[model samples]
Target: MISLLKASPAGDAVSALLDCHDRIRSFTALALRLARAHDLAEPEARDAAAAVHRYFSAALPLHARDEEESILPRLRGREPALDAALAVMVREHREHEAAVGRLLAACAAVSARPAELARVAPELEAAALDLERHFDEHLAAEERVLFPALRALLRPEDHQAVLAELRARRT
Candidate 1:
């Protein structure tokens, strides 16, 4: 289904992905705020950390899996050059999962003491950068190659049907 905001029945999945990007960007900003805060154990800090952790643990992994398995594979058939990018992107996804694990552990260990968040901050920064880079590159690849290829390969009805199936699975 299209968003109320949209006049057309464009792929809602793309908008959902963009929404995820916005959330991740906000969460990264919040992480920086927590890093600077004196009380890392504050409720706000913990809540933000949990939100970020939950996104990475649940939505992020599932989205990446869907993209890699459904979208990327389908796109790969049309563009042979995507093979290298898809392979590297898959590896980066694994790294992202590992990094999320470390970041969540850091949040769980947060206390009034300096040592708690200090350990997590560095790991979080690296992971956040990695995620940002992966996201940028993947989106760029899709915009430049995948989506354009799919534009020709799949009909409008096909696009709508695939999106409907995806949203069904998502819900």
Candidate 2:
């Protein structure tokens, strides 16, 4: 798990989200390693499964809400060109959630039945790859288009409000 550092100062919403993208990448890589292991024993598989499940379950939803609720609405008025991309992102978030659920179930099953690990490994890899591929472009769009617009257009109060809303969701 990524350790908590200093709290993001007001107006650092974009930076925080970017940091989250990094964590997402890190966790996804870790999950892929765990999933692709050829001989995953019960205890190790359980630990890895728990870690992956905890991260996707906890952090991923908050990240989606940060985009869907806080960031996207603000962008719609200022950057109308982003409407289609935003819509796609919203749909992809739902897809990601479903994928995570399936991956979690498969991983949990492996913990209970170690012999099943080899059979389900491909499913786990597919789900992780799906999320990773989606996020690669999605994060690029946010960094390239959305976040820069937010930084340039948003008032200090707007930043504060977004940061507060994001923190509230986590709590």
Instruction: Give the per-residue lDDT digits (tens) of candidate 1, residues 38-61.
Output: 655566666766666666666666
lDDT for residue 165 in candidate 1, whole number 0-100: 49
**Whole-model alpha-carbon lDDT for candidate 2:** 0.78
**Winner by TM-score:** 2
* Best candidate (score: lDDT): 2
How big is the positional error of residue 147 in model 1, measured in Å on the Cα after superposition? Answer: 3.6
Instruction: Please give the lDDT score for candidate 1.
Output: 0.59
Q: What is the overall TM-score of model 2 with all chains considered together?
A: 0.85
TM-score of each: 0.70, 0.85
| Residue-by-residue lDDT tens digits, candidate 2, 61-123 | 888988999988887855556777788778878867777887778777776776777788898
- Model 1 is weakest, by summed lDDT over 10 consecutive residues, at 1-10
Off by over 4 Å in 1: 1-9, 39-41, 111-119
CA lDDT of each prediction against the hidden true structure:
0.59, 0.78
